[model samples]
Target: MSAVFEAMIRFGLRLAGSQFPVFIFPLLVFIVFRWRAMFSSVRENPAARLLLSYLLVVFVLRFVLYMSGYPYQGRYFHPITILTVFPIAGGLLLIGRYIEKFKRGNLLAWLVLAVVAASAGKVLNPPDPKKWLKDIPDAIRANAPADGRRTELISVVEDRRLPFYAKSGYHLLMPIFGDMFRDAEIFLADGASETGKKLKGKGASPLDLEGRKGGIKLIVRFDEPTKLRAIAFLWSLTPDKMKADVSFQTVEGGDFLKAELVSSNQEGVVFRQELTAKNIIIAIDVKSNSLWHLSTVRGHGFDSYQVFTQGYYNGMMKWLPEEDFKFGLQSVTQAADEWGGDNVFILFDATIPEVEKALEERRLRGKIMPVGEFTTHKGKPLSLYRGIAPDRRD
Candidate 1:
């Protein structure tokens, strides 16, 4: 019953899309007026006809909701779409009975007017999915600490406009990007085999994992000693049945010992462990059968991969507000400092001006570097921001 209700709601939103209301309103009026004779057969006994009419009205209302991108149980709501349409649908249904006595031309004109009004109302308010995605990076960059040498860094990517099938497959790009930061150690959980292959074949330099399954590798470079932090920004908006895991490994030739699981949510998991040797590996595993096929088998240095999940400055802010951002940063920073480092490389997205401001304020300019652009699950380009600090020099 709940599922049916949910379905009904979703259907309404789908039907409320810009083009749908225009098409549906006229058809609805026509159905009501054209079927009046049929409807009137039991007008004296209106219970059956009324029930059918009510159901029809409910179906149409649900259709409008569906077209407007309002999912069943969606957290966000577009006020104009719902507030305006619901009343209109109800009023039209009520008027349909009275309008049956009017000329067909007048009824048609009324239908046209209702559609025009609905369209105008909807057009006046548009949902900004892009703006929402863009804000995440901005917030992260803003609160980023200026003392890049002392502050730890993490990056998150949130892209919601992806095709349903591609959503799970895109997380595979995380590790591929993680391999690029040479100044500090990094880890990524991605679900894209194509990205892994590209990273392995490119021979870019930072990634240097040999004889590893799933193209997992570690890049180590020398910089100032500092702290470390972890940030998880997810493009998979549907978090109901997702699991993420981050594991640390001590690479002894070819085998791995599970070190720690840092963070896990419906989207994925992140874990952090100290790397004492040059040969170490971090694996981010997203537990979803839908993503397993994207696993990679080889490792390489630098190659372009499809960014299923890319790190960005602005996008992180959307997921983590200022307070949470500070905490996550402090987590990595403290960890790096305890491990005896003056600098820690923080991987993030560059499009966020806030992150840049934070870094500048902390006087960590030399510590910051913009790596590359990552594509969202929708295939839009997102900037890659990285903060590089090592433990010994600072």
Candidate 2:
């Protein structure tokens, strides 16, 4: 309980520090000396008492809600900051009095002048921004006209700043674009993946273990003999069949090899071992007379996309916002198929061959124009393009 509260305090402080200037020392001094005086003043003044009570109640309520498992951001503290204006003024006045008592003359004046000069430094010598996409919104606004046309855009940039920064009138739809967008040389169980279905393998899919009782056998074969590092499976079991004896065998119908178990829980199981083999056989023997189901299987030697996709199926926040996007998970081709807009903005690194082919197939590439080109933090080019919808004449 102490650790959770400590973490909440640290998180709140860290967020506040990033968003606003921290006058921690002055606030601490005011609290140390004038707390009793503040309470007495509040008691004498009804408005002050009400205001203080409101501030404390609302501020504590927000923190309590955050502690109760609500995700909070720095901006959520704006209300409390607004309510602290009078208290901040009081703290500044106390500091000014202390400074006067210490020096007796031009000390307060000199401090005010110093603060003014320091504040001026922001305009005179501004610090360089660390974000590569900071200028993207302005660039988009400059190029894309706000003609009141209903515009729908798809952003693969993985940053929400574009939508927040860009001018209104355009609808931004960001698909699940992250590590899954990267091309993988091999993604295991691709054939088993049901079209337009999530985590449901079909036919002879090793991942399909629904409505099964007793022991289950799964065989996964690679295109060629590949070096293996880790293999993971995600499954659900009836409460009665909580335990399952899992083993891996490289040879067909051969003895199972003892691999090191990396992780095991109700969610799934993971095994880590170094082996070069074309195929692997997984054997699961249930300890009870109940049903067990397997949803996903991932291997490390192949593409990391599969591993991430499996994690996504097993309830990882692989998608943006860590909540539902109101749209199904889509590939570049799939998103293009569903797009019904005249003008489309692709705000990501869409210079890859696969993305290019998808755009070309939809005839969107024929009249594509570059909106902006900027270098990513990784030294790679991040290009934004505006694709006009295909005309019926051609």
Candidate 3:
């Protein structure tokens, strides 16, 4: 019996698919039954009434369950079938009486009314399918790379959240050139002594230096002359105080000649020079005072603000140490009494102590509002403090 029922169900589904008109069969059945019930008197037959009532209960139950998040396997078929049954049962009860009264004339009018009612119900209540199916297809199409092509290599100084294609293998390309270009190889240094060791595995030539020092060195090669020009421009602009010596070298018969700078200076006068082995070392004494000065001037304003109080450090303003805050407050505050008002919002991450000391010194006055529970890029939690200074005007 179970096998036979399964076969019947498959046959019904197949028929519904092959014959589009069969989609309305449930609605048609509902209308026939409803018309019969409508024409029958309320007290005419108890058995008929009971059967109609049972069918009505089933229809209501189906509708309620479908709307209340009950999972139905066959799309909207369950709801539509249940709704059609209700209307058909009503029509069954009324159609017989109508047929006796107006015969064929009533058929056309009833059909138009039924269609309007069904369409209105459909519009007011719509079935919403799960979103994954639609969203997945669109996402796949949107993320497909241009022309379905991939770059061989990409480099970045820091790991930024980039597209999937760019993160496969990061090459650390330096911005010394006019434009950034990725070198096939990268050199890693521990201080400066081990720089040569890192390059030993790679086939590229190692850079020769006069003295080994605390700083690190990296060498990259470029194939094109334009690339070299960009590198030279970058080297010239590098801050001289950093004490980085960048020079270019030409390949001799079977070895490399000494490196030379692209530009040179004499007695404060700047002169452009072609990079050659002989005159390269002569430009080593040129000072990069202007570059260092610019960098220092740009960073001058960083120390202007200060924080105070250990409670503030523990709370939201944790980034500034309490001691540093004390120094900053002392530098900016005119009087000790200025620390009593609530007019400044000191923003800092956790782990600062200098700020707390300043609050103790009476350089800054204000209610300390501690804000903790913030995450930094390295996933460290910090706090912030906010309060207005006493003298500020609204």
Name the top lDDT candidate.
2
Least accurate 10 contiguous residues by lDDT in model 3? 282-291
Better of 1 and 2 by lDDT: 2
Ranking by lDDT: 2, 1, 3
TM-score winner among the candidates?
Answer: 2
Off by over 4 Å in 1: 1-29, 36-114, 132-155, 158-384, 387-394
Which tens-of-lDDT digit does each residue in 1-394 have in candidate 3?
A: 4433543464456434533242255446555565555447435977657656766686455444432222334544544455445555454435545565766455646655776677677768866653332332233234333444322111111222222323221122122231222222223333434323433221211122212233333433333444444344435433453323444433322221221232222211111112211112211111110111211112222133232221332243221222332333342332122433232222333333434554556634343433223444455333334333445523
Model 2 TM-score relative to the real fold:
0.46
Lowest summed lDDT over 10 consecutive residues: which window, candidate 2?
A: 285-294
C-alpha-based local distance difference test score of model 1: 0.35
Candidate 3 Cα deviation (angstroms), residue 104: 8.2
The lDDT for every candidate, in the order shown, is 0.35, 0.42, 0.34
Query: Which one wins by lDDT: 1 or 3?
Result: 1
